[model samples]
Target: MQTLRTDVAIIGAGTAGLSAYRAAKAEGASAIIIEGGAYGTTCARVGCMPSKLLIAAAEAAHAVSLAPRFGVLPHGMEIDGKAVMARVRSERDRFVGFVVDGVHALPEADRLVGHARFIDDGLLQVGEHTRLHAKSVVIATGSTPVVPDALSGLGERLIVNDDVFAWQDLPRSVAVVGSGVIGLELGQALARLGVRVTLYGGSHGSVGPLTDPKLIDEAHRLFGEELHFETQGRVVSATRTDEGVTLRYARADGTHSESTFDYVLAAAGRRPDVANLGLANTSLELDAHGVPRFAADTLQAGTAPVFMAGDANGVFPVLHEAADEGRAAGRNAARFPHVEPVARRAPLAIVFGDPQIAMIGKHHRELTQGTFVTGAVSFEDQGRSRVMLKNHGLGHVYVDRATRRFVGAEWLGPAAEHIGHLLAWSLQMGLSVDDMLAMPFYHPVVEEGLRTALRDAASQLDRKG
Candidate 1:
């Protein structure tokens, strides 16, 4: 067999792998990047960018439907599903093309295109031809959607988020069986686009990583009014049929019922794609999830000359987080036994559903009770929200009772994605409630809602004094 050697070897060619490759090279290390799949990021292929494209179309259609509320009387507005899918696909391909082109610019000899398996620590087998001895390795194989065995019988009728973007046209009806970010965003977008969507959430009753029971309830109430949502839904049986697929499900009460749909999307979530990497052959320890144990700050998989980054690490699957971890992993692998921990950004996550869902800094569940005070605002009557009729959600900003510092926020409202960034920055800068309240807020805008929430927090602080 042919043999190759490198100072650093990066597996997978997605965002993290590419970033790792660049960072390793920048660290003055000879690096080679490997991939066994298409040369595009998950964000470009089926994750962030493509999903947002679909959401953009859904938002446009939804906005038109709400034109009557804004005193804009319009004629008949029809949604062309084919055209919507066509634009989504075309634009998604454009984004993917950019990433692919960057991959092509890399040295051809440094790229390997075959499945890589760990024959031993620091040793990888790439197909049958190449035995690569990597001084240090970075595993950025990313993640794959998990399909529960119960839903496996649906055959071709079963799909995932990746399958959704490949559609020639949107399906007439889709039964979404997860209520996390992917499920909520895609399910709501489909519903807005006039597709029949039935979303079945897990028993936790939480949506989009928000753990505040109040926010969760508000979310269920809001989404239930807009779409067919079952907060606690479980699938017991699924099978393919001549027409479509049949499913037996259990509701919140544990009662069994049956339903049928054109397609069943197993959006339960994703797991690190490490099952086929022959990890058992390596000496590195595995975590509860069966992935290699790695340090988040340095991205090192123990003391071995190996690192883990991006979705394969199974920490935060966000794109920016992946990129950051990739850089850390690459730098650490290049430096090896002399690695240092890198400071990470403040925690932030956003769900792109209507009136979006977001959490900045620490999530609600992570905070201890009686140590923090909650300052809330309801967009039901907020100025700009009322003006635009896009105000129908709640927001809560958490402040430390002792320090009066802005700890975090969980909000569901208009401009949540933008607001999330502001809150994240506040957390990073250690801004206090008064510090945030002192920031200027315009006369009439969604940001005023944030100001109002901060003002409320300030008032609560005054009461304590």
Candidate 2:
């Protein structure tokens, strides 16, 4: 077997691993990145980039169909599922190619193309012929879609984001299991593109971790207009038939229901891809879920030389967070004994569905009633929303009641993604409600709606004093 040594060995060449590699190399350390899957980060391949491409196509189709509402008469509009998917794949390939090219440009010795598993602490076997000895290791193996055991028997009838994006065509109808970000985005997009979509989830109370009552209600109202939502039930069983797959579930009301679809999308959630990594070879202790307990701020895996980052740690699954975690892990791994802690970015995430859902900084669950005050504005009557014919949803701003400082925000409205970014930046800078309200908000813009929420929060603070 060929033997090699490096200052740092990074497993998984996705966003987190690549970022770690660059950071480690910048620290004047010899780094080797091992990848078993295809190049291009998950975002560029199946997660964000390709999914957005499909969503954009779906939005265009939806826009044309709604032309009549805007005093425009349209005729002969048809969706070619195969062609739509082909363009998505063609464009997706280009993005993936760019990332792949970057890896190819790296020095041959720095890039290893094979599966790597720990032979023991500080030692790894690549495939069967190569051995790697490293001062420290960084794990950024990312995550995989969670398909429930009940649906395992459905086989090919079941689809996840990975399978969906690679399809040459979409099924005529789909049952999307989970009302989380992935489920809501794809389910709505598919429905808009003429696919019959029924979304199933735990309950109609919330989507994902969103806990704001107002935002939750707004999401239900807005998304219900786009797709069929079955939020009262939990999936219990699945079976494959000649036509497709049948899903059976029991509702909260103790009623049983079953439905069949041409395809079933399991968007339940994702689990860290750590099971096959031979973590048992190291002294690292894993939690019940088989995840290593690591410091969120330092990205260090306990007191061991190994570091964990990105989706592999299951801290935050978003791409930007993965990159940041990777850099921190790489830098810390390279500077092991002299490690310095790095602060994590304020949490920010967006769902690209219509009236895009977004959460920034602390969520409602993190804030106590006596400590935090909330201000809100309804887009139902917002000027820009009415003008754009998308005047649906709501926005809420949360602030420290005593200090009037921006704490967090949640919104379900047009341009919530943009609005969320503004709030996230403000919160990161420790800006107060007064500071944000003083910032320029254009007349009749979606952002003005955010200003209203801030002002409301500020006023509530004043009332308390």
Best by lDDT: 1
| Candidate 2 structure quality by residue, lDDT tens digits, 100-167 | 99999889989898888888889999987789999999999999999878779787888898988888
In candidate 2, stretches whose alpha carbon ends up further than 4 angstroms from where it belongs are: 203-205
Cα TM-score of candidate 1: 0.98
Clashing pairs in 2: none
* lDDT (10s digit) by residue, model 1, range 129-183: 8999999999999999988888876777999999999888888888899998999
TM-score of 2: 0.98
- Runs in model 1 with CA error above 4 Å? none
TM-score to native of every candidate shown = 0.98, 0.98
